[model samples]
Target: MESTDLMKKINSFALRSFRDNADRDYIHARMAYRAQLYPQCFWSSLHALEKYAKCILILTRTERVRIKKNNFDDVGHEVLKSLKMLESSLNIILSQQTIDFLKRLENGARFRYLEVSWHSESAELTILDRAVWELRRYCNSGLYSYENSPEVKLLDNVKELLQDIENVTVENTHIAGGRLEAILKQPKSPARKELVWKNLYFSNSKRKTVWLESNFMAENSSLFLYPEIIDELTKYTRIPKEIVNAYKNG
Candidate 1:
């Protein structure tokens, strides 16, 4: 593949993996919050938003040199750095409240070691969840835009076609082999079958074919599914009824 195609594939794969990973982190964070594991909740929430920021940067094709210059390449957990880069590189403005929240969350020691009880109350948890939701919404919208672009749509269609062809080929090859094996097992031509089977065995012995299983990640892991907190939070926090209902049904 050409360099451009290679980059596209890399970015596309990163975007997808990061997006799903971010969602997984978010769900885990919520689970931690509901369980009152405050430190884990804070850490997981920050990591989730960090992945969201990285997804935006990757989709924008932000250069590694640029990220390195900003020192974002050095610290993967620096959500603020990613946010700043996203703002500067893409001319996108984020809320000051969100920025401040991220800055406070960036204190690695606090969340890592349980130095502070930042999310004790339902209101505090709601605030943190709102920030996470905002970041998730933004990155999701950006990814949606890229996915719906003409070039990406075309590439996705071609990939689906190729996968379909591969599946059909595998199925047909298995069917043909089964049919041949059944014919070879028939009792009427024992001598002939033995001769043919020996020849086939010798021919197969001369060449080795290794079948490797594809390790593509499953798209619908249970971890990514919406957790029970989506409904529980509504009872604790003053989240709007419509929003809560939508989330519950979503």
Candidate 2:
């Protein structure tokens, strides 16, 4: 499809929907992290960040935003670059640690392939949680009050958009913040500390044996979805079990 026609298919309402999709990605990332599916976690986190960045660009940039297929034009799968563009364009700064985390995620294929890699214990997920929180804040603000430029107004549904922007109220997704915020900002609990330790060295034979023997595995049993890990994540992230189960079932 032509880029302009594609842009016409997207509007402020579609832009607002990114928050919901990103929230689901955020939830999935945490679930994968809890499940010790680090590769999946990395991809999910990257996806969540990419969507948030694109959403931000759509809201703040006056230029035409081209989304061909599932890939953002000139920004395919490189979340760090997308975020840098967002930072430069919107003057929204991110911490050096967050930048480093996104850089690590940029090579997510390595993690997926189980190649030798370096990732911090708990810190990766924490950075994702915090970054998502900040980005979601920008999205919510833009959704409710952005004055679309004349160029943006060319997109379909812009005329009907945000009539109730003042009435916009987001629920407590991981981005909207709750337990995840507390976990990010406050001290960790003993279970959380242990979970982090286990995640850090999940390759240890003894820990792996115990972890496998435990009932933490998902319904398939081969996937090894740990309940204790989920509990720890829930303690910190406050994602509902239904959402976690949705990820598990699908």
- The CA lDDT of each predicted structure is 0.50, 0.50
- In model 1, the runs with Cα more than 4 Å from the true position are 1-8, 70-73, 108-111, 114-122, 140-250
What RMSD, rounded to one decimal, does every model reach? Answer: 20.6, 16.7
lDDT of 2 at 231: 47
Residue-level lDDT tens digits of model 2 in 128-245 = 7556654555554323322334223222332233222222223322233323333334444433333233331211223321232222222222113443355455665555455457
TM-score of 1: 0.49
Judged by lDDT against the true structure, how good is candidate 2? 0.50
Which parts of model 2 have CA positions greater than 4 angstroms off?
1-11, 14-17, 62-73, 109-111, 115-122, 141-250
Q: Candidate 1's C-alpha lDDT?
A: 0.50
**Candidate 2 local lDDT, residue 85:** 54
Candidate 1: tens digits of C-alpha lDDT, residues 1-250 = 2265665676666556776677567656656655556667668878878887887666665667876886666447877777677656444344666677777668743324222224343333444544654454334322223443322222223333322321222221222222223434555743333223312121113323323223222133121254455556457655445444654565
